[model samples]
Target: MYIPQLSNQKAFDSFILIDGVLHFFQFTIGSKHAINRGLVGVGEKYGFPKDMAKWHFTFVMPPNRVLKVPQAHQGPLKDSKLYSAILDVGVEIPVE
Candidate 1:
C-alpha cells in the first residue's frame, strides 16, 4: 500500500507498506535531505511506537545524485538503518 503526502508542508513525501514494514519516504530533487531522526519523529507524531522495528525511512533521489550525510546526522541514521533508492528516468511505479 502507498500513501502520498497530501500537503506540501508535510514532513515525508510518501508512505509505503511492503511486507508488513512501514516505510517513510522523502523525495528530493536537490540537496535537501531528511534525517532519520526526523523521520522517526514523524512516525511518533502520528502515534506509531518509537521502537517499532518494522518502521523504515527511505530517501529517494534522482540517479547520480550523491547522498551526503552530515556528520551530525550519521549516528541516528545508522541506528535507524536508513534505506535509500534512486529514481531514474523510464522507471515506472504503477498506480492502481
Candidate 2:
C-alpha cells in the first residue's frame, strides 16, 4: 500500500495489510495526517501507527510453529534498525 491507495489521509496514519503472513512487508504513506499519527492499538505501547501505506511484517515461520508475540512486542514491529536486537525477558514492566 502507498499514499495514493486511499481516498485521503487527513486524521491519522493509514495502513493496509499487504501480506497477512509472508516473507516480506511493505507500506505507502498517504496523507500527512496518518503519517503523523504513527502506530495505534488497544494500548499506547504498540508502536505509534505510521502513515506508511504498506508495512512489511515478517517472521521465520516454521512447521507447526505457533508464533506467540511477546506481550510487549504484540503492539508494534521493532525498528528495522534493530534487526538483531536481543530479547531480555529478565526486565519486566507492569502494564496498565
Candidate 3:
C-alpha cells in the first residue's frame, strides 16, 4: 500500500506498507528539520510502538545531494530503531 502527501499537520511525502512494516518517505532538497519533524509527528499520530521496530523512514534526494541529520534529532531517530534508506533520481534499469 502507498499513500501520497497528506494535507494534515502530520503530512508526509509518501507512506508505504510492505509486509507489516510501515515506511514513511520524505523527499527534500535540503530541509533536515522537515524530515525530522515529519517522521516524529507521523509516529505519534499513529501511536507507533516505543521501539518503532516496524517503522521505516527514508530520505530521498536528487543524485549527488547529501542530507545531514540534525544533531538534536539523532538520538530519537536512532533510538526508535527506524530503518532508513536512500534512492537517487534518474537511474537506469537493466533488462533481464
Candidate 2 matches the true fold with a TM-score of 0.21
Tell me model 1's lDDT, rounded to 2 decimals: 0.62
Give all candidates' CA lDDT scores. 0.62, 0.29, 0.56
Q: Clash number for model 2?
A: 20
Q: Tell me the tens digit of each residue's lDDT in model 3 across 14-79.
A: 777667677777665663534454566666776655455566667666555556654334555554
Error of 3 at 39 (Å): 5.2
Decide which is better by lDDT, 2 or 3.
3
Per-residue CA lDDT of model 1 for 25-55, tens digit only, reads 8776656565545665666667654555566
Model 3: per-residue Cα lDDT at residue 40: 65
lDDT score for candidate 2 against the true structure: 0.29
Quality of model 3 by C-alpha lDDT? 0.56
Counting clashing residue pairs in each candidate, in order, gives 0, 20, 0
Each model's TM-score? 0.59, 0.21, 0.54
Better TM-score candidate (1, 3): 1
The Cα error of candidate 3 at residue 18, in Å, is: 2.2
The prediction achieving the highest TM-score against the true structure is 1
Candidate 3 error regions (>4 Å): 5-11, 31-50, 71-78, 81-96
